[model samples]
Target: MNSDLLILDYEPAHQPAFRALNHEWIAHYFTIEPIDNEMLDDPEGYILAPGGHIFMASHGGAIVGTCALIKEHKGVYELAKMAVSPRAQGLGIGWALGQAVVAKARQLGAHRVELLSNARLRPALALYAKLGFRHVPVPPTPYQRTNVKMVLDL
Candidate 1:
């Protein structure tokens, strides 16, 4: 990890940064889905209130990346909404965030962590792979952009 980077749990004040960072990357590659709008509109209600968690990455006091762990069932979580600011792409911010989120999942007692992603996001896929995620059959998904599914057993 970088000396200046911090990965922290989601806070109320981070709402806007959470929404903006994710929306920027999603829109850059594909249009947002209704499910995305639902959570982005009410993260605390949709995620935190439901026993899930979000993680934010900051560098030198500025929020630069975000990721979420959405509880889908007992002992299982969906890793979602990971995004890094365009300017910070090559700095390993995403990798740091991913590693932090997975560690959080283990601490939370989650037995498995899975994710739905688009196959076209090669860099993100590679990052997940390096973090111990492996390919699985693509399940039915709300987002038209999603074509790849991966999971990591905690």
Candidate 2:
């Protein structure tokens, strides 16, 4: 993690950055689906209101990264919407955000965390594996781009 990077809880003022960061990465590699719009457009409703959490990464006073822990069931969370600014790539921001979200999940009494992703995202997969996530069977998902599923047991 970069010495100056700070991972903080989501704030309403950070909504634009959160949306932009996620939109950038999703549009770059895959199409943004309707579910993506639902979440990105109203994270407070779909995420935070449901006992989930979102984390934001700040470096040099700019919001460079974002991640979320979406409550799925009691003791389980879905790690989603993680994105790091391309300009801030290689600064360990993604790893830092991942760690922060995992820690947050644990703090929120989560026993497990899962994520939906694509096999094509090797770097992201590597980061998730490094964060203790393991590949699992892909279940039916709303996103057509998701071909990989991972879970981290707490």
Return the top candidate by lDDT.
Answer: 2
Residue 47 in candidate 2, Cα distance off native in Å: 0.6
State the C-alpha lDDT per candidate: 0.92, 0.94
In order of appearance, the predictions have TM-scores of: 0.97, 0.98
- C-alpha lDDT (0 to 100) for residue 57 of candidate 2: 95
* Per-residue accuracy of model 2 over 1-154 as CA lDDT, tens digit each: 5779999999998889989999999999999889998899899999999999999999999999999999999999999999999999899999999999999999999999999999889999999999999999999988999999999999
Candidate 2: misplaced stretches above 4 Å? none
Candidate no. 2 TM-score: 0.98
- lDDT comparing candidate 2 with the true structure: 0.94
Which residue pairs in model 2 clash with each other?
none
Lowest lDDT 10-residue stretch of candidate 1? 138-147
